[model samples]
Target chain A: MSHTVRDKAKLLARVRRMKGQMEAVERSLEAEAPCGDVLQLLASIRGALAGLTGEVIEGHLHEHVVHAENDAERDKAAAELADVLRTYIR
Target chain B: MSHTVRDKAKLLARVRRMKGQMEAVERSLEAEAPCGDVLQLLASIRGALAGLTGEVIEGHLHEHVVHAENDAERDKAAAELADVLRTYIR
Candidate 1:
């Protein structure tokens, strides 16, 4: 968490760009752009999501999984990461 | 494209929800919410994106691939879809 806080600005920026991409998708649909155009927008949105997600996962790995004070803490962090991955990578 | 046009409202609705979810992500960071909470939000966003992407892909399959007037049209559609998928499934 502390680690993520350290990188909060950068991560938030990624999220904001992604948000903007979503707005573009909305606009494209409203304008009834071609399906190819919408698909291109979706590709970018997904890329942004993957970028943000990767950063978060990396921070967790460094903070809780690798740098945890004890085995119990490490296991908990790993489990939580695994659980999130289950939901995320779907 | 006509297939997507028919489903425009529904697809736009999905994009709007995803946009709202992205805003929540922004708020969570601005409030400095815990990483766990942010990860949960990311999971939901990814799910919503996958759902929308699936629908679009299906529509393309019906319009450009399965229902194409000729082999040339089907090939072009498949190629475009493949290109999008290459970027998307990253």
Candidate 2:
């Protein structure tokens, strides 16, 4: 089975929670809550989505890159990941 | 200024790198690289995208939630973030 399939239940749970947070943001907007409140809600939702993305990334790393059998493959994976990280963190 | 606006150049550079990684994945597939190689490339791309998501999340947390003017707003933001995290990490 694919790693994602193995972790489907857990990943779906996160997505569901993110959906709920998004709904709350929508409701806040509809209710004309303070702009500050709405912004806070949006920030929370963004963080939730980020968490979900991070989980998937971690799973991919463990399943694909970290476990590769050969040094060349591992080096390629590490280099690609490093390059992206340098850009991402900036 | 909007946090994203202030950091637009940096964010765009990351996005461009992610785009390149995605293209590399595509090329690997086209060239009939090993499945493991393709998977590793995909994993790297996913990690890059996740990194971008994380940056956005961090910026939102700092700009919107952390800096809110009142206790009530902060509490609300914290609660929402906590709720989402409870599900996200599972």
Candidate 3:
């Protein structure tokens, strides 16, 4: 549980770093801004959103499934695992 | 890329199988199985979960990020990359 929380924090930090950016989009593509100038920027935003969702799902699966004490717990864990897979598939 | 899409499909299939296993685990738990057995199953499930996560992250990085075509693509790739990281961190 505690670990999950810490992990979440770490994820956020990572996001912050990414935001920094992607190094300003690689300095605007080496100043060669073209090709929709940032079609990628939009993509980036989408990615961020997906990332957040993934994190949440991951945390939930790990914490709940792992914490399980009995067979049910095991099952839960399995489900969590599946969930992670789902994310990948998506 | 096409490969990515195909990979996604494979991952999804794996998840489906895992989901079934999870269902079985639930049944076992309901059967009042021993805590030890259930615990073992839990561990396995956790492993599977981790494995799936790792694979997805690896694929995304190697394919999308590395293959990015332009600065925008790079940014998007970065964001997507961040997204995956967030999940891992969590």
Which tens-of-lDDT digit does each residue in B1-90 have in candidate 1? 466788889988899999999999999988888777788799889889988998898898889788998999899888889989887654
Model 2 chain A: worst 10 consecutive residues (lDDT sum): A29-38
lDDT of 1 at A20: 87
For model 3, how does the per-residue alpha-carbon lDDT over B1-90 read when each residue is reduced to its tens digit?
433355545655554554444454455445544333333444444455556556655655665567766778778777866754664454
Off by over 4 Å in 1: A69-75, A88-90, B69-73, B88-90
Give model 1's share of reference contacts: 0.67
Chain A TM-score for each of the predictions: 0.86, 0.71, 0.42
Ranking by lDDT: 1, 2, 3
lDDT tens readout by residue for model 2, A1-90 = 445566656654554565465456445544545444444555565565456545655655675578866887678666655654564455
Docking class of 1: medium
Best by lDDT: 1
Supply candidate 3's per-residue lDDT for B67: 73
At residue A42, candidate 1 shows an lDDT of: 89
Order of all candidates by DockQ, from best down to worst? Answer: 1, 2, 3
**What TM-score should be assigned to candidate 1?**
0.88
TM-score of 2: 0.44
